[model samples]
Target: MRKLQQRLDKIKDNNQAADALAGRRSEVKPESASPVAPERSRGRRRGWLIVLGMVVFGFVFGELALTVQGWSGPDFSDARRVGKATVVSCERRGPIGWGIGYWDQCTADVVWDGGFSGRYAIDRRNFFHADEVGTTVTIGEGAGSRGGGVVFSRPELPHRPAVVALGWGLAVIASIPILLLLGGTFVAARDAIRGVSKR
Candidate 1:
């Protein structure tokens, strides 16, 4: 009976020691259940900050693309041409006009007399004389020598709506990344704030 009593006493002492150790551990750190919450919130905030930085970079890139694609200013002054007659060798005249076959059209200021001057289109088709003013100049569009002169007519260029549309499309596409980044940042910030508030 004495031996049985001693065994029971030993068991009780062991259980008491285990309970005391558990109590000490609990008191040492009371917030062990949710220690990772603040860390997760901070990580989310950092992610949002990174996204905002990326958005700013995307906006700058988009602006640069727009500036590059837009027209800077009007065409140069050499685009205008004025002279007395084709026989006078207007090619030697200062600031006469952009040369023939150039992309831009040249307008000739033909001076017949001291006071008689008229504007004419100088292109591959029509060579204007002083007397040709006020007369209808017909430009040919067919092949061969018959059609290869600049008549008094406006030059036609290919339609460029497709190019304009393509430029706009590219600009919008480049902006999409910025938009998404902003949205993601907003969502992350909101979530982080809510998490902090809940804590």
Candidate 2:
């Protein structure tokens, strides 16, 4: 009977040790080990974030491309020809990601006095006051080959090549914070996943 009681005591001691260990583990484990949201919710959130990052990156890349073009484009005095340009056609293109928020692409063809013609693409909002087929607009002079010698009729929007380049240079500064935020989120998510895996 004594041996049986001792055996029961040992069993009880083992259970007590296990319970204490479980309590310690609960205290030591961090809530962050798991995702902040459910796995499904996290995946959705990450998908949205990736899309946001990609869209923003595309804009930034385009801006920088324009900036570089402006920087490398030739002086305005060498314009091959300058005069009234008749708009042949204008196309509005948009609808991204399941056709949501498609307010971005516009391109028009302008034929100048010398029969010189070129395509002008404008991503900015309302680049031309009255850009449409058969519209008469003045050809922008001094635009290097980068701009395809095309310029918007709206003067304020098209700055000097140097100024355009400088503006983009400065604009890139603002993207730093956004990039950091994206990077941090990615790192946090990765770490959370890693932590879960370690368990």
Candidate 3:
């Protein structure tokens, strides 16, 4: 009887061990056997998202660069009569960048032939002629045939090449960050989609 009982206990122990092994195998089968391909696919998809983001960033940078480059110009307005004289000046009311400058026109009545005459005058004593392009005009204290030359105003032909170049450079630099963000978002979205599909 003792031997038989011992044999029964051994059989029970063997059954329990077998059951534990079976449970472990079942748990591992679904987790470790499959889904490797899906994981790899997800990684590749993430990489593609990064690439797409880079392209978008490049486009944005290029656009910004073009916009900045287009801003290199003198703000000018058509000739208009202020008081009694016609004046034409560059109307720049904002900050001037490296390659930008402001020009203004101020005019007043002048005595000509003992009669009031309308004349056009630039903001400063510097007489800016249409023919004088790419030239700097310095306005100083002086009165001319027109009314008092526009008080203290000057025209400067700033170095535009550097400004344009810098703008382009900055645009290019900004593209990198934009690309990174876009790529990250795309990859994340793609992964999410894939996960949903798998589910």
Candidate 4:
């Protein structure tokens, strides 16, 4: 009978030790589950969201500006034809990822009215013209010019009008994400305000 009572006491002691350990663990859980952790997590997510929205906004806005410029081109109304120039080199650098050509560059040797002579780079958003070396290309100057003045092709190279349309379409499509992000931010802000008012 004494041995049986001792056995019962041993079992009770083991259970109490287990209960105390579990109590310690339970006490530790509240600190681990701090409300600040969730707030920090939300802050990080909001920061990332804001960064993404800015990137999208900048990209779309830049593309829109470029599209407008490409369609309208430069103000050539005041430009005048200079003279014939010998094609030194011609290159088309563009069409990154898929087939979107960027710009056309043409180098030519020409002399200005002021007796200035040198090779000039005719860089513009113009269609690629396969001009061979030694080819005679018509060149021109803009209205106000100085110091390696504004030189361009007499008949500006042709650009794909479809590209402007494509750019507009892509911009509109990309804007959907911006709108969603903005809307989400607005809703989140509204909810936070309401939560603060309630508190």
Best by lDDT: 4
Q: For model 1, how does the per-residue alpha-carbon lDDT over 104-160 read when each residue is reduced to its tens digit?
A: 224554554334666545533223333444444322222322445332312222224
RMSD of 1: 14.8
Point to the candidate with the largest TM-score.
4
Q: Per-residue lDDT of 21-50 in model 4, one digit per residue for the tens?
A: 998888876657778988899999998987
Per-prediction TM-score: 0.39, 0.36, 0.33, 0.49
Colliding pairs, model 4: none
Q: Which runs in model 2 stand beyond 4 Å of their true positions?
A: 1-75, 78-83, 86-109, 113-127, 130-137, 141-162
Candidate 1: deviation at residue 6, Å? 2.5
Pick out the ten consecutive residues of candidate 4 with the lowest summed lDDT.
67-76
Candidate 1 at residue 142, lDDT? 22
lDDT tens digits by residue: candidate 3, 37-132: 889999999988877777766666665565565444222221122122223333332124322333333443332333445444543312343334
Task: Rank the candidate models, highest lDDT first.
Answer: 4, 2, 3, 1
lDDT of 2 by residue, 42-105 (tens): 8989988876876577566555544444323234345556655454544553433312233334
| Model 2, residue pairs in steric clash | 76-142, 95-102
Error of 2 at 157 (Å): 7.5
TM-score of 2: 0.36
For every candidate in turn, the CA RMSD to the true structure comes to 14.8, 9.4, 13.4, 9.7
Q: Residue 70 error for model 4, in Å?
A: 3.4
| Better-scoring candidate (TM-score), 2 or 4 | 4
Q: Could you tally the backbone clashes for each prediction?
A: 6, 2, 2, 0
Evaluated against the true structure, the overall lDDT of model 4 is: 0.63
Judged by lDDT against the true structure, how good is candidate 3? 0.52
